[model samples]
Target: MQRWKINLSVLWLGCFLVSAGMTMITPFLSLYLQEDLGVEGEHNIALWAGLIFASNFITSFFFQPLWGKLSDRYGRKMMLLRSGFGMSIVMVLMGFAAAPWQLLLLRMLNGVISGYIPAAVSLVSASTPKERMGFALGTVQSGSIAGTILGPLLGGLMADHFGYRPIFYITGGLLFLASTLSWIMVKEKFDKKAAALSAKTSMLGNLKKLMRIPQLPALFSVTFLIQFAMLSPMALIPLFVARLHGTSEDLAFWSGFVSAATGLSNMIAAPLLGKLSDRIGSFRILVICLLGAGIMFVPQAFASSVPELLVYRFLLGCFIGGLTPTVNSLIRRYTPDSSVSQAFGFNSSSLALGNMIGPITGGALSGLIGIEGIFIVSAASLLLTSLWTYRSLRRAGMGAEGRTG
Candidate 1:
């Protein structure tokens, strides 16, 4: 790889490793909680499982703004190092966890310390010229999406074969290499003036600056919706498969397949849409992708079989995949160079908050309503977001017209 390409690729791979490792644990966490930790009955296991999973995102949400600010201060490379090192240590510690509380605590700690994607986004944003940003960020985002596919398949196999213990060790091992490569490969043109511009403790000040940017409020709402829609399926996918597919073994295979399918589609679509957005504009691309995702969601609820479900997921993933990169591109357009990391940080926080909410809420909705309700909820959210995005673009078009007139 070219030096810059290697820097982006390896850092993205590091993100993929950590994300894959963390996500790979999800389908099995409750089972592990009850069986390994010896929780008192199903109810306690259920509650603890929720806490364990939610804690990571909650911690991420609390720290993302801070991490984003720190990335601005310390350098993107420093943030990746911080994330890789932190996740690696915590992931290994989790393998040694003796109790539910211990595992949950470590997961939370993992969240607080992890900073890879934010740092990577900052690096890409700062490095890529404005015209090429959509393609650059989209290509980078695809790695995380690719990890979503590979992590679960490989992780499921690892969990089934070597057991959960090995999963943590393997994840930690990958992370160690990722961290090492990031340290060696990724370099920023560190400016003494940029270093001096760092406000290490002024995360709130940075957030305030981001908040004042034009259309940020609307963009933030759209961000929340995009995440909320994506994570609804993610939160209870394993369980959904169990409920919808034939057997537990069937669930495992189908669950892994669906996760990977989305990643595959996303891997293909994100960059293409992002490149198209570069030609068209982020706002227009966002609407197109969001609406396409919404249309794809309809078939998911009505799929008669596992194969059908997979097909629908693959198609939907094509569109849903592009939504995130489009949003990132739009954010970059509005953000000043000084606070780019902070803006991405808030965007990261939105996803974390949604992940924390989406799973628990989806699970609850599945229980109280039906499995199909998840699709309905996700589709509705995406539809609303698509409309908002379209309106925003139309208004901007008129704004240009008025400026000329």
Candidate 2:
């Protein structure tokens, strides 16, 4: 196999391992806190869970750019190892935690060290042929999406059988294995002198230079809005499922299905759309996916039954799946080779920013405007962002031409 193909395959597994480990604790965190850590009250357990969950993103959001800068100066491989190994250790320690505070601190530390996905992206983007970038990124993205979709189900099963602490230990062991595979298999044609020179440039200087790229800011906003809109309805999915299903006995199963439905379609659609983008234009795919996703959201808001909502969500996933790969492909096209890692790092920060805000905003919208309102707000946000992206592309003269200006 070709070197780029080899790297993509290995990194795909790495992405899946890291993403699954990160989310594997999701279904049982509250239960673990109450049972093992001795959190006394329901309110406190909920509060601790929220804090622990948000802590990772909060620290990750601020530190990703720093890691990106280092990746450019050193190599993406090193960053990947650092994140994978560091997270593995932290996850293991979480299993040993005797108190909620200890777990929270460890979770925060995990955030500070997190950058495996962005580093993998930077590594693949730097190595893949420009003509194949969209397809490669789309394929890579499917790995993470698949892991996320399966993590909760796996976690719930493992928690029921092996218990919570063993789940963490197993996840940590998987992370270690993933990192070891990358260390042995992946390769990068890095130039040390180029990295040193790039490192000499100030972070502010790099930012200023990157800001001059005509379509970069718009692309970044597209990433943020895509994440924000996609995640806004997630926190309330169970409640919404209950509303649609009434007192059905299969409510838990149906709710889990509704939650996983979008990711399932997204996993199937990402690579196909990516290949199409490689042939036609990522810009065209971006516009269509954004608009299509926005339109799909409206039907979801109005769905009268669980089946109706599931259908709409699956359709939305088909469009939404393409958004990130297209955005990453655009970012790689527009960014300088020497600074692509930093560029992706900043983009990763934007994603983390969305992760931080999306859940809070979703919860707030659910309380203030009701569950359907969250879908409407998300749809409207995506629609407006699509318009903004369209105008931005037109003004930059990249409309349909797909030139890497």
Q: What is the lDDT of every predicted structure here?
A: 0.73, 0.82
Clashes in model 1: which pairs? none
Superposing all C-alpha atoms, what RMSD in Å does each candidate have to the true structure?
4.1, 4.6
Distance (Å) between predicted and true CA of 363, model 1? 3.1
Instruction: Give me the candidate number with maximum lDDT.
Output: 2
Q: Per-residue lDDT tens digits of candidate 1, residues 281-400?
A: 676667778898888887888877777888888898789767777777767777788777568767777777877876666655665556577888888889888887667645645234
Clashes in candidate 2: how many? 0
Q: Give the TM-score of candidate 1.
A: 0.81
Give lDDT tens digits, candidate 2, residues 327-369: 9998998788988866876787788788767765775556468
The TM-score values for the models, in the order shown, are 0.81, 0.77
The most accurate candidate by TM-score is 1
Off by more than 4 A, model 1: 1-12, 34-50, 72-78, 120-142, 181-214, 278-281, 335-341, 388-405
Model 1 — which ten-residue stretch has the worst lDDT? 396-405
Q: Over the full model, what C-alpha lDDT does candidate 1 score relative to the true structure?
A: 0.73
**What's the lDDT for candidate 2?**
0.82
Cα misplacement distance, residue 83 of candidate 2 (Å): 2.0
